[model samples]
Target chain A: MTTSTRVSARRLTKRFGDFTAVDGIDFEVRAGEVFGFLGPNGAGKSSTMRMVGATSDRSGGELSVLGLDPSHHGTQIRSRLGVVPQEDNLDLELSVSDNLYVYGRYFGLPRRQLRGRIAELLEFAQLSERAADKVDNLSGGMKRRLTIARGLINEPELVLLDEPTTGLDPQARHLLWDRLYSLKQDGVTLVLTTHYMDEAEQLCDRLVVMDKGRIIAAGSPRELVDRYVTKEVVELRFPAGQARRAAPRTDGLARRVEVIADRLLLYTDDGDATAEHVASSTLQPVSTLVRRASLEDVFLSLTGRQLDD
Target chain B: MLPTPFRPLSYFWVSFRRTWMSTLSASFFTPLLYLASLGVGLGSLVGHGQRLASLGGEDYLSFVAPALFAGTAMQVAIGQATYEVWGACNPWSGAYRSMQASPISTGQIMAGHMAWIAARALLACALYLAVSAAFGAVKSPEAVAGLAVGPLTGLAFAAPLAAYSVRARHDQPFSLVFRLLMLPLFLFSGTFFPVSQLPVGLRYLAYALPLWHAVELSRSLYAGTFEPLAGSGHVVYLAAVAGAGLLVARRSYEARLSR
Candidate 1:
């Protein structure tokens, strides 16, 4: 991950009349870095991406992409930036290659240049064989690859992907990740939003966890885990929110207790020892297991363990 | 050189291409059936007034021909401003969202859709007018001008509806459109009978409708009867209505797409 800045966002805000979707968020992405926005549903990740992508307007604060103001030079900015919307918005009526072609045309790419680049991007995304196939005829993975290809048509300096793999299966998501990785290796800067912690860890160079229009945490995958959670965690299920009620059970067994939706995670150096302690406690959890702490834990710790309304 | 000025034209082409075939197939048959069956079959059953007003100035088909042409223009406008609007603006799979991400501005998108409305309305008006002419409804050459202005009328009527379409938060907007624009225009636009012949209370409502102006302009062109002689106001009213619609549509596009 090259650490030269490519995307600079300062105090960006999006207000729809009275409701604020993104409340003054600031972040910077360097060229060749796979920066990510991690948050759950309604977390303002998409709104932030829209603002940074140069499509939607920022209600307040300064925002810039590729050294241009989004408000004044949106068209020029869009000509250089690529955007993959949250949904797989491939033109169903058009073929896979045509989707990329039409998108390229929109950016005012020369036909000759776009044609050759489409051939290369098709091969890069591993969909050259499906070039003639209609978008609806392709698999979920194929559609995503096509979207990525469409984004790359402008040979963009920064590509904004809003929840790129939100609905993809494991295989599809991995294939997409591989394509993204290939793009990164080529020195293309990518900004993506995803709820999946694994996705962020796998693709993002550094990331931020946003919740309800605010960035609660920001760091690299390892940096965040190291900063917020222990190396390992022992999970104890005590039926529904009961694991949460038995919060004091982790006092002697491990260090800090994180009560998530389904289980209580006990942060400890010795996961097996923590599990053994859970078995001995008067508070009988329904189940007990040991595993490594992930970004999911970091997210909970940073964004807060409380449920949002 | 700035490539081409087809950004608006291409946008219209894309929208028009989606349903143009179906619209063409339907419109082609609508006028033929209405003119052939009604002009011959229904004309024999109706009285002197029907025969005179419709086809022959003596045929009911001829008399109602101009009205149907205007109504069809309104229908086309309504269709574009409603179902197509929903398809284009609905959050589920809005094309505008995708287009907004590109270099295409919100104003360009609105221009594209409105242009498609006018283009499709004109095509339908041409076919309907041709059938009316073939059936001996139009006595003068002026009726061809009806086809020319029919789409303009549609553009005027559909623009406000398109504005509303952009602002529509739900399917309920279609209902409001029907009650506010479509029904009121259809019932009072001098589509069936002359607005002057209607009750004074309802006549003013007809005068306010974009479709009424379209129907009057179309009928005048068809029968060479450009009377009531307020020629400048008729043209001004149509242009003003179109201008208002454009202003609202541009605002709506900015509201929906820029958000």
Candidate 2:
């Protein structure tokens, strides 16, 4: 493993009896980068993250975290790694600050130093005012922030977050994204798993699109969009049920044509050229929208299925 | 001496501080009330001479104090070990999973919980013993020797219960332990009376339990007599149960938490 590689897995596999959760998959996470596992609910993203966190042992494959084999140096590897699970497991009985203090103590950090560290983490999570409140009393966003703060109490080298914003409002999601971005700025390597294309597009520098139990595609959001989809897409709406009938008229106008629901999508190298042809053609449409291709289109083009189901 | 690297006791200390009031009254006061109502109030009706002879020339309060200490140890240990393991392992709390993600090993987490239980059991026993003394139930200076029985009795239940608790998918399994196993052991384990007075078959059944061994050992200590072979037998029995329980618990915690 290279010094820059924080996590490296070769043909990593996990099986529960006969049902495989994670098939043979190869991936690597480097230092100071936001790496994401973008997949649906059952795509085995969390299973992979658990193995990398050194909490779950892989059934087969060579896996290393921070240049140490997890099977042999699990505790040593975990000492340098931090994990925020999909669920909030903060001590519901303790105050917000106590949660950080107790979690820091689990890392064997001295009590004298943890006081200042907890204060700093509380500030970073924007939860300084609610430090003394019970964890249960806080809102969903505050609890999530506190959980992340607890994960950072030991000042880890790499942090693994599993769906950090799964059930949060838009404002809460943005606030959490800000905190994570600041952590990335401080050079904390992040490995997160989420099914949200927008989140992956917004946060990840590199990501892998997984389906079933395998990674079907891996690249930056821009790279995957460029590799899998055309440069632009023209959305044509032909009032009510005429979209399916209008799709045939645009067969030769665009590189690829697809009719989904009430709209027909025309994928082309140049959307303006495609739109000009549609305007002058025999086809009659109500409205048209032209936009750049995105990861959502990439997922559909590669899998023939939508990412959000 | 310096604390161990993880200092698992701190987990229990912090948790205890938050609920010490309830823990104190519930675990610490139950034994005192039992001594007052059963050992004193009921002892008044049994009459000193007849009861003394029947209890082997000892007052009802003195004879039952050590036995109750052993029983209380079993109660307190089981109470803490079972629920805490369940709570920590449950998906909602996932405390053990959180700890497993840290530098602490599964063994350390299990050990830390055990250490915390030991501290609570010891404190409860010490308080019970002190209250026993104030009740004028002190028969011999060796009465303090009953102190060891508390933790041993508690651990005898705690370790194996912790093992069971980790594997428990829900709270339903614990009720079988409470209704079927622990209650029978508490009622028939010689805590309230001498097992020698029990029926022949029931006496043999009582002899097979760890609490019975703990009670006899504590009684012997309070009575200021030394039966080396018998003492060794009781000690060996409790030590074996505790050892086996610890082994099973370690394996269970490892299997459950390290997955």
Candidate 3:
């Protein structure tokens, strides 16, 4: 086995007794790519990440990280692969930097080399000031950055993050995104799982939207939106049920119009033109806005929900 | 074989350093209390006139010190193997969650934990013996010759228990086994009053526990009753427990850490 390929899986399946967590799924992630698994809770995203991280056994199928089979080369694979699980698993008793140093020593890294790496990683994660502080004292965001710094102690070729920004504040999420984007530029392959549409769209170059342990769709963010939603969407609102009464304005203006709750979605190649057509028609609109379709629209079209819970 | 060329010695040192403070407290405090309270307080109640079956009569403290050493060893070793091991491996504890993602193998973790416990057991047993010596509890100086055997018995018992700890999702299984299986073994393994004082039906458990042979061989050494030819059986039993415990702990570690 070689330290390459980043990630590879074939028919990878995981089951806990009778329940199937990650069904037979196959994929490959090359070096220097940001790949994501999008799915809801218990949809097997974390379970799949566990198997790939070499901490959980797969009931069936072939899997490898860094061109090495996890079952046989677990220590090697783990040494080269950084993993951040759904929870912040930092060592609470130790200083934030000691957590990184102690973990680095486990990989047989000497103190001389480890000290410099620790400094670099701490700075990279923006945790330089918290180096001497105990892990328990840090806020949720600082602890997560510490976990990320620990994962990179070995200078791993690939990093796996399961819901990296699940509970962080908006500012924290943006900071994590900035750090991850730099990692991408540094050529570190990242495999993350998140049900958040915006996080996936922002981080992943390509992603597979998973449901019930299966990938329903796979493509880049723009590609998925284009395939599943129109170029432009119009949101129409009424004070009452007048939107339903003015249905004539929607006819022949677009390919499809779906009504959910109190808003009507107008799907068309040109949203401004559709707005002009509606203004000229018998329909007197209350408000009008046109914007490019997004991953959220794709998810809404596929799953029929504004956002996953 | 380890794929990452894992340094077992390094793992051992780090684990030892991390746990040294706690080990010292348990080793010093637990043994000191039992020896002082039981050997001094309780031994006064049992006196030298007390007869303890085939091993023959002796001072109560001298008679019970070796058995106490063995019993205390089991308690500490098994304690380290179970709760501490469980805490490290459980995802909720986040110890293994952090370590397993590094170069350390599950086996190394299991070994590092048990090895530290074993060393601590030996240290505690030694500390207990030194206190017993100062108290004039020893009938023969040859008893010091067998201080090496005390931790071996613990290692034998702790290994399997450590193995079990790696799989326990909670504390219930160990509680049942300790209360039902281990407690009886401790009481009737010729350690306390006598195995013969127990009901005939319960005598079989004393024979089954590793502690029975441990207590017997220990009393022989402390009382200067060594039999060059006949003592092999007791030695073998302790060896078997040590060997079996180590094997199971190692394998269970592999099961837990290796995907």
Best by lDDT: 2
Worst 10 residues of 3 chain B by lDDT: B1-10
DockQ of each two-chain model: 0.34, 0.49, 0.37
True contacts kept of 3: 0.53
**Order of candidate numbers by lDDT, starting with the best:** 2, 3, 1
Per-residue CA lDDT of model 2 for B33-86, tens digit only, reads 998998898877766524477787777877787888887788888878877879
- DockQ agreement of candidate 3 with the native complex: 0.37
Model 2 over residues A1-309: C-alpha lDDT tens digits?
Answer: 788999999999998889899999999999999999998899999999989988888999889899999989987888898899999888787788877877887888888999999999999999999999988799999999998989998899999999999999999999999999999999999999998899999999999999888999999999999888899999888788888877777868888877776788889999998999899998878888999988878878877777878
Candidate 3 segments exceeding 4 Å error: A1-4, A59-61, A236-253, A257-264, A273-289, A305-307, B1-23, B48-57, B139-145, B172-184, B228-230, B242-259
Worst 10 residues of 2 chain B by lDDT: B1-10
Q: Could you say which candidate leads in DockQ?
A: 2
Write model 1 residue lDDT over A1-309, tens digit each, in one string.
124777777778898788888988989888788999988888899999888888788889888688789899888888788888888766676667776766666667766887899999999889999898877788777787887787788788889998888778999988888888988898889999988888998999999888889888898999999998999998888777676668864677777887777688788888987787777778787778888888888877776653232
Show the lowest summed lDDT stretch of 10 residues, model 2 chain A.
A299-308
Q: What is the interface RMSD of each candidate, in Å?
A: 3.1, 2.7, 4.2
Candidate 3 chain A, which ten residues in sequence have the lowest lDDT sum? A1-10
Docking class of predicted structure 3: acceptable
Q: Give the TM-scores of the predictions, in the order they appear.
A: 0.87, 0.94, 0.86
How many clashing residue pairs are found in candidate 2? 0
The clash numbers for all candidates, in the given order, read 13, 0, 3
